[model samples]
Target: MFNISLRHSALPIALFVFTLMALTKMRPPNLWAHTQFLLSYDVGTVRRSLIGQGLAWVFESGLMQSTIFALAAVLTLSGAAAMVLFMARALARLDGGAEVLLVFVTSVGMVTFLCNTGYLEGALALVGVAALILPVRGALPLIAKCVLCIVGVLIHDIMLPTFALLVGLQLFLSRDELPVASRIALGALPVALTAAVLTALFLLSPDAAESYDTVFATVTDRALDFPTRKGAVEAVMSYGPGMEPAYDSVWGSDLYRFELIYISWIGVAITLWLLVAAARLISHRPMLDRLALVAAGLGPLSLLLVAFDVSRLLGVAILHAFLVIAVVLLIDESARVKLRSVFTQQAIVLLLIVNVVVGFRPLNGYPEFGDDFPGAVMELPLWWNMPPSGGRLTQNPGE
Candidate 1:
């Protein structure tokens, strides 16, 4: 179970406050679109689908903007806390107290992505991270993990298939710990429950038929929104060829693409690095560990199939897979394979590189370029700048 002792409470509290202030200062203009559309229940908005509006609706409608941001900070800390505790427990189980530094390094990587610019993603990604590390030996934890995995899909459908497979793999591998009956039921439970939830939310609504009609129209409209060049073969083409410039006027295209592409490459590199490490570490491990390595290792392939924002997808997948790798490393550490030796001077170099790349966002003259250095330090290098707050149109459509 996750206990909040006095000693550990301070860290989460501090993280919450720090993240709250940072996210507050880091708030971009475009954020309003996501919140406003979700809060208004505007099912016709095609850009951000309603798949993952469960948590967004809660935060946006249940609280004032200022209060809701604080809630976001709390959720961010909660995800960070999960990472720290999970890593710590994994290390302790391995009797690798000497390699606490490795735990710290891993925790920092998780935080870098989990606490990234988007407040909503912080919660969604945290739920994803928790699924990766939650204790599954017991029935309760396993069920909870399934529920979270389902909820994660509902929160953002872009990575649904990838993460759903991940949840399934975990359930299938827990056969040794769980009875055959339990394993079979758990495997089927998540998808069943998810279907139930979706039915209740969208299908059972007052305008059930109209809801589906609106959803179809919205999806079709969004698909047509991005037309290819005259002779292009695919619907989605790379930026700069045929697509018109759609960057917000405030960003002015000065540093967006270069920085974005830079981070995308970084995301790919980190994803490969973590998976390669897991492959090596889990070579002789139990079936569960080996299967998890495969699932986490291949989860990033979603990038190729889905054209959602590359920066967020890659970054989130990298961190999510990194957490799985860290878990495998700790679980499979042999008497011969020591943490100290696993991460030597090379680990220091890796940590430094991650901090530099993940720490800095592209220069967008945010908070007035040189004006808010403190915000820059806490929330600099936002993956993308949103339109200003309060500038969003917020008329409720589905009310």
Candidate 2:
């Protein structure tokens, strides 16, 4: 009886373990994250200062590491809850059982949230989740959606591509329910609002009145410990020169180096796997619908041209794809039927085993790209056996 009960309760056990792992591995708010909340209108209006400005109004100079940590936890938990709810609803439609849920909990997109806790990624994901839920599940006013998009952009301009992909796909999928003019306006409104906000932030916001040293001093004074990554604070304060130093490191000619290329291909493979899974869930749809969905899923990758955070962006793309898929599963019976046919117990069990082996890792800038790739677990044994004089593992293996 005990063994039988344990077998039946495996799913809940797995979920509990996964949550514990995420909590245990949670990192402290880094200097970049601290710098984001430290910035405010008092320093002069700047890009990505909205959150800081709002916190400043409420905290009235009481912002500290504890506050930032608490806020980060809230945002991360809120986003995770939203995502799990959506996933649960979608799985319900497919009659997906323990194995399928296990696959989801272990999947790269979900695990990215677990491993890379406490960053704007959580807040950005929350906005994306709102985009998914509000359109289908709620009667949220158009103005509210517009306001959400505006807030998303203000949080970080990276929200633009993510917003575009999600909102555009949702609008596109609603073609049968809404009129042509309404759809066009609905689509264009967010774009226009985003553009206005971006212009105001970049062109109209006042330049920093203080030097990097002055701003850094002010930020460190509020912290319990010395903030690491001074360059991040410098970037926020100086705006231009401080940003230049990262260019060569992140986007240098070595972009095409063999290791980076290999890691990038691994990311691409994982992305393709996700796209394939989404496609399978909607295989019964028309060719146009299928193509459009795939296109939207691929859209976030365009951020590559401007951003060097390959793994993080790919994780965003994967989550964006999942959110879009969940929306479709909730609203479209045809898609749900396709998902049911594709996600059999045997298939889900096999996928779950594979995902568990892949496990989870932090997906950030280049080299550390993609959670699906072999990470610390795979490399640790080799490191343990290496000669003492070999030194630590550097980003570039040749070094």
Candidate 3:
């Protein structure tokens, strides 16, 4: 019997429109994102080729740059809408204080969507959202969840960490309902399949350097009018070769330093919000539960050591946290009541204000791209922003 009136719905609607406008202004799907469309199974089974292959199957042959960009934008916006709707629906079931916290989290997610437009992460997020929603609604069967996990990994292997977090938390929360052996097998299934998929991608795919050239040529030839960045193309191409090349590329560079500092600041903000929002639910949980939550939440951060895209991994981590919160609120009435009691209207409003003022920067440090307002507060004090050394390769052209 939960009904959400138009008055209650205005915030999410406005935020969605705001996201659309922001994306339009930004004019995203940068060279890197566009390059992804150039890849497909035509070149053989490759990492992150699922979307590209699907696009190719749909479009048949050569596709215009504008068309590719449009498709990417549609996927990004669709994923953003899904996230917003999920939050809004969840918000309706909560009390005032919890509602405000949900808004805070949703706003951050919207900003992230804008920041990551045109990337596979947006689509991956949609898959993640679907996974979270189905289980919460008691509609997803175990076999289906496993299949979805496989689909997510095929879309992009980076999703494995988040999948781990999702599956682990679900199993942990439902521990009492399931037998010990059942829990262990269900939990291990996804991990084993993910490993198998990744191993196949590595062993089956052609040599990295050769495939990189073929992909680059295919992309450039298809979009003769589009200006493709070699670095961005290489960045994606390097995925099949594993993280060693990525590590070597960014290790001693100024880009590495900038990423370290920027993520450090953003990480603090994310940690604060999570602590405040989850304090009630987690504060009184048993030591094992707390440890499990922490481990699951930090799971995505494992990608940071190998990937130079610090913000993207962090963004995934944020999504994992949101999923954890949503699942807890959906199933644990006691936790919800506890949260309502601890958070006051005044404090919630104050936190929301701080969240707005602090704003969010792009996953990459390119200020020239994307909306300029609500820049990170840390940017002012650090003043070390010289757009990272080695120019375009080190700098991600913001989406």
Candidate 4:
């Protein structure tokens, strides 16, 4: 009874069970363990997802993107800290009851990204949130935030679509709620910003876009598939000239498999969270609960809908939001603490611990590299073309 009872055998057994439990519950690793991958390539979402994955690669290898991403991350972290302090100050000046939730939403998007990714996409997103919540009662605040967001567009084009999405989402959801003049005013800034960017990109040219991507990719090492990336992109894009979809799906098989795993989990968590939220809202429409859901979902669903290529981003965004929402929903509002339900609470804590462990691997194994090594990763994408991974992909990706 006092003996350890053959602990070595139990170690592998324990790890096996733990690994199985995590994989069964989630496919992605680290901070976004609960997330699912996406399928659609809605332009905006694609750019951001690419920014994340591409940046991770560059940072990991200490290759093409290391310097730029390192610099960008530092810059983003600094900028976010400053902005949050500013946002908090700005919030203090406001009087709306929803303003506190607005600040929390801003913090979740800005602060969390600063902690996790710190890519240019996240940085640009931070600026846009600053613009959105800068409290524009008069023209000065509005003009300032809009201008800041516009300026940020050059840093990452992903922000453009996000701006459009936010404006559109607000317009669609609040159309009946807002007066006509308020609607027009709300539409003007984002519409103008989108038009200007589209015109600029249109005028920029294939050669220019290619050149810019190359330079940016070189600088950040986060370029989507560098045209010359010999392994995957080249093998596919280089296929005998006549190809149906310009992308190289042939070389992309491995990438696609990982993509499938990530997207499937995102679907599971999002639908689960939304249904749960809907059910709670239907039963008891508390202002606080509604605020929690709104804040929790805002950035993620926005990114998912606007994503351009990879479904992985949806998986990335959804579970992150779902976990936070689930926590907020179940927590005891009156006690100054709460719980969504027993299941969700356990899931959230377990997920938090796992993600922390996952996050550290990229740092330890890779060291100079930004992401985890082979064994460190639980991501199916990382193990694509392998036995179990390939088998996992057999059933039409997410199905």
Against the reference, the lDDT scores of all candidates come to: 0.45, 0.60, 0.60, 0.36
Question: How much is the lDDT of residue 183 in candidate 1?
Answer: 61
Query: Per-residue error at 162 for model 3, in Å?
Result: 1.7
Which pairs of residues have clashing backbones in candidate 3? none
Per-residue lDDT tens digits of candidate 3, residues 1-399? 343233355555646566654544334667778777766777667678788778777777667887876887788777766666665555554565335534544455455556666778778777877766655213346566667777887787776787645665665565536665665565566666777877777667656566777876776766646766565555544444343332355566654565566454565456546644654576666665555566666667778777766655665666656666665666566667665555555555565565454434454336632232223332344457654232333355333
Kindly provide the TM-score of model 4 when superposed on the true structure, using C-alpha atoms: 0.46
TM per candidate:
0.57, 0.78, 0.80, 0.46
Q: Write the per-residue lDDT of candidate 4 for residues 1-399, one digit (tens) a residue.
A: 132232224333433433343222221112111011110112222222333344444445433333443454455455444433433332222222122223232221322243333334445545655565444345686567567656555445545544443433333223325665665566456646755864564444223223433433432333322122222121111122343323334325653544344433434454355435433532343443344345434544554443322343443343344323323322323211212232243443444343433221111012211232222343345556555343232222111
Clashes of 4: 31
Candidate 1 stretches greater than 4 Å from native: 1-37, 40-63, 93-118, 129-141, 158-166, 172-261, 286-292, 329-338, 357-399
- State in Å the error of residue 151, model 3: 1.0
Report RMSD (Å) for each prediction in the order shown.
10.8, 5.3, 5.0, 13.0
**How does residue 274 of candidate 1 score in lDDT?**
60
Candidate 1 vs candidate 4: the lDDT winner is 1
Off by over 4 Å in 3: 1-26, 136-140, 236-248, 272-279, 282-285, 363-365, 368-399
Q: Cα RMSD for candidate 2? A: 5.3
Residue-wise C-alpha lDDT for candidate 1, range 1-399, written one tens digit per residue: 332222334345434543543444333213322232232244532222343244345543333435444555565556555555555555453333324324343332443444343334555556766675666567788778778866664554433544454555555544546675666566556655655554444433323223444443332332222221111111111233343323223133423343244445656666676666556655655664565556545665565443423444564565556555455554454622654444444553565456434532311113232222222333333334753222221221101
lDDT (tens digit, per residue) of candidate 2 on 1-399: 111123355446556856775675455555566666766666555567677778877877546677787887777766766676666656562445344555666666666665455667678767866765665323464566777888888887777777655665666666546765665566566667877887777764433444555655655655544464554454443344444434345455333232244345655666666677777776766666667677767777787676565555666666766666676676677777676456665656566565555533353222343233344333545666853221232342111
